[model samples]
Target: MSGVQDQLEIKFRLTDGSDIGPKSFPAATSVATLKESILAQWPKEKVSGPMTVKDVKLISAGKILENNRTVGECRSPLCDIPGGVTTMHVVVQPPALEKGIGIVQDIAQTI
Candidate 1:
């Protein structure tokens, strides 16, 4: 156990008030890694479109974490991070819908 550190447990809070989990990851894990894990374990019933890392944003301690940054980099910013499970908010921004769909609405209103 030369340089071994305790794993960090993170739980995600979604927009609908649903939570993902307190998944464990090495302290050195990157934000990108966390996003990938979420996509892999995302509830099918909740998501419909492609769930990519770009669609996921992780916020902790009121700060939006950088994808390239490590979880350890964020540890100090959060209060009692090591003392208990670190809670982060996961925001999934819906993709913009196509513009053509609006044409139907315009035609209906004209009639």
Candidate 2:
């Protein structure tokens, strides 16, 4: 309540043209936290949803925001219009295959 002015309205636009929120968050909130929120609210009907925060990527102003950066830090002048909600694109990247396992097996066969 004290820092209501510091609260930013954010909406996550998913790849399927669905949205997760237009919710208010403190400026100090981290990108990782936003991902966790998205994971929690992911639509049950949607297929291939992100399984963890690591699978989610937040993009704003054509830049992929780092997990360590706070929401305030990721905001750009063009995207942070006063009293306007910021829309960030959400991308879910599936975990990579385990290539190391195959490589180790090959080395063992060679030995």
What is candidate 1's lDDT per residue for 1-111, written digit by digit as tens?
524345777888877888889777888999999999888888889755336898788998888999999988877653644447888888876545324457777888999
TM-score of candidate 1 versus the correct structure, residues matched by position: 0.75
For residue 25, model 1's alpha carbon misses the true position, in angstroms, by 0.8
Tens digits of per-residue lDDT, candidate 2, 1-111, equal: 558658899999999898999999999999999999999999999988998898898999999999999998988997688789999999998765336677888999999
Best by lDDT: 2
User: lDDT for model 2, on a 0 to 1 scale?
Assistant: 0.90
* Candidate 1: stretches off by over 4 Å: 1-5, 48-50, 97-111
Highest TM-score against the true fold, candidate: 2
